[model samples]
Target chain A: MKIITTVKELKEYVKNIDKSIGFVPTMGALHQGHTKLIKQAREENEIVVVSIFLNPTQFLKGEDLDKYPKKDEADKKICQLSGVDVMFFPSVDEIYTDDEVSILAPCVRGFVLEGFSRPGHFNGVLTVVMKLLNIVNPTRAYFGKKDAQQLYLIKLMARQFFMSVQIVAVDTQRESDGLALSSRNVYLSKEERQEALKIPQSLHLCAKLVSKNIRDRDEIVQKMKEILNPLELSYVEILNRNFEVIKEVELGNSVVLVEAKVGSTRLLDNIWL
Target chain B: MKIITTVKELKEYVKNIDKSIGFVPTMGALHQGHTKLIKQAREENEIVVVSIFLNPTQFLKGEDLDKYPKKDEADKKICQLSGVDVMFFPSVDEIYTDDEVSILAPCVRGFVLEGFSRPGHFNGVLTVVMKLLNIVNPTRAYFGKKDAQQLYLIKLMARQFFMSVQIVAVDTQRESDGLALSSRNVYLSKEERQEALKIPQSLHLCAKLVSKNIRDRDEIVQKMKEILNPLELSYVEILNRNFEVIKEVELGNSVVLVEAKVGSTRLLDNIWL
Candidate 1:
């Protein structure tokens, strides 16, 4: 596998490949979730490109911009083992410059859910994703359903801007205990790791309720809240595919999302019905 | 020349043609200025595509969006005569949707000169241009130096996003009477038309002074102001290519810009050294 760091090199490397290309963009410190995305991309395309950038703009001022985990050596090994054709690890300076044009998230849809909890986060994500998409110019780009809101926003951007690449959303990967795999999982202590399971447990309960014909959104949320008792819950929202809150859950279109604090780290999990 | 009114048709048409594409985006009302851009695109690439979209987002609430000139029949004839391969004329609905992801201009460079007069104008321009560029996926894109700030911002967006298309800046086109050619000129009465000539006249006077080795920015602006007297002047400033106000003009990097209101219509013109 080729390891590239600069945008120019990556562009030159991908410019001549005539085969169907698939791209997977992520931050470093790869986990099972990232592996799932890469494996899916490998299965679907003749060439798979993975970008690992810990973008600073996505982190708020007091957020974990400085302390975010970076496992560069292990990530390279994982990509090599996962059949990645190229692994892009660009430095901040190589990808961005001072006083540049930025991409903004959708006004309404981008400002709710994850955007509400972390304002301006999707803006940074959209901006960086746009740059990566332009540089890669892949035939298809892969995104995991774990970041459901992000996947939706990216789909919106691609359609709005008329980008040519197809966005392929892979299913979310989970642990044996039903906890969604996240790079941030490394931040959890032994005790806090056990508490993080409650996040997915709450989402699972909501999914079970909806599957059993519990159509009322309020009732589903209330039941999930009860199961999430004693934990500092950020929000338990029942939203349609567009992230708008709905009164009744539409079987195939509904999503139940939850966020909570486990120790000092925040965990997010969602179930798309 | 084929004329396409829908995005889907345009994309399909362009996809079948296996040749290098050069694109020029405009807002109908073809004038000598627009022809210069289209003509250059035709000369440079195997296929040339022109789009006429009167973007509403670029116009402020009370701006001249509705009053903006539209000469569709004339524009179509001009495109055919200029040897354009494809002319895309998408309606407002075909080009825009309810909520969208937008492109914001660079902080400092995007908010000066014309951007200063119209606060969010560049944001709209950049957003639409981004959409058109993605839709066309051209080998090269052409813009007239008549809209100097807009050209600079587009170039910046292409580079900042690592977009692959090459941007070519065609020189400004003028009439026999020295008035800068603009579609908006149709809004000017005969009297207002005569008054518009002073804009380019003042800019020429500044160019003559700079040729005589008068390099001070303020002195040249003051001299141009003398010639623009009795007219409602918006601004007359000199800046470097980076759009920063310079104390002394560097011969190859200087740009002298002027904006003035001829009756109710505001006009802009610039000379790049």
Candidate 2:
């Protein structure tokens, strides 16, 4: 697999390859969730390009911008094993300059859920994703459903901007214990790791409730909150596919989302019905 | 020339054309200035696409958005005569939906000059330009040097977002009496039209001063203001290509810009050294 460290080099490399490319953008420290995205991209296109950029702008002033995990060597190996055609690992300087144009996520959908817990997070995500998408010029881009809000926003951006690439939303990958795989899980201690399982567990319970025709959003949220007892819950929201809150969950068009603090790290998980 | 009014139809039309597209985006009141941009685009690429979108976002509240000139029949004839292959004229609803993602211009370079005078102007310009660029998927895009700051910010957006299209800057077109050609010039009464010539005339004096090795920015600005006397002058400033105020004219890198109000209409003109 080819590894690129600069935007120009990556674009040049892409230009030489005449194929339908699939792109997967991530923040590095690859986990099972990231591999799922790459594997799907690999299966769908002649070339799969994955970008690992720990963007600084997405993190707030007091957030983990400086201390965010970086497992570069391991990330490269994972991409190589996952059949990635190119690994774009650009430095902050290479991808961004002093004062440049940026993409802002949808004001309502982007500012709620993940955006509310961490304001301006989706702006950074959308900005970096746009840069990666333009550089890769992919025919199809893969995004996991694990980041439900982000996936929705990206799809919205692609449609809103008239970008040509097809956005393929892959299903979220989970651990055997039902915990959603996240790079941040590495920051969890043994006890905290166990506590993180409560996140996905509550989401699963919400799904089970929906399956039983318990469609009331408030009831589902309350039940999930009870299951996530003693944890610092940020929010438990049940919204339609458009990210609009609904009184009753509409099957195949609804999602239950939760964000909570497990130890010092924030964990987010959601279930699409 | 084919005129498409919906985004879906335009995208379909673009997909079938297997040629490099050169695009010129405008607001529909075709003047010598706009024709110059369209004419250049026609010359450079296999297919030329011109979009006439009076993007409301670019106009601030109470900024004459409703009264912004629109001469559709004349513009269509001009495009046909200029050899444009496609004319994309999407409605506001067709181009935008409720609560959409937006493109934000850079904080520094985006908010200088015209940006400083009309805050959030570049943000609106960049956002719409980004949408149009994505929709057209042009190989080369044409922009007039008349709106120097707008051109610079668009170039910044393209680079920052890693868009592949080459941005070609066409020189400003002018009237016989040295007034920079603008659709807004139509709003000028017979008296206001004569008064508007002072804008371009001021830039001419600044250019002569620079040619004579009068490098001091303030001195040249002062001289231009003398010629623009009795007219309501917005600003007469010398800036580098990056739009930062410069102490001395760095030949080949300086721009003399003037913005003035002729009656109720605001007009801008610039000369690039």
What lDDT would each prediction earn against the true structure?
0.90, 0.89
Model 2 chain B worst lDDT window (10 residues): B108-117
Pairs with steric clashes in candidate 2: none
lDDT of 2: 0.89
TM-score for each prediction? 0.98, 0.98
True contacts kept of 1: 0.96
For each model in turn, which proportion of the native inter-chain contacts is also found? 0.96, 0.99
lDDT score for residue A35 of model 2: 90
- Cα deviation at B189, candidate 2, in Å, is 1.1
Residues A70-108 of candidate 1: C-alpha lDDT, one tens digit per residue: 899999999999999999999999999999899989889
lDDT of 2 by residue, B1-273 (tens): 899999889888888888999999998999889888987887889999999999988888889899988899999999999998899988999888889899887888877768878888888898899999888888999999998889998888888889999999999898889988888888999999988888888888888887788899888888899899878877788889988888999999988889888899999999998
lDDT tens digits, residue span A243-270, model 2: 9989999988998888899889998888
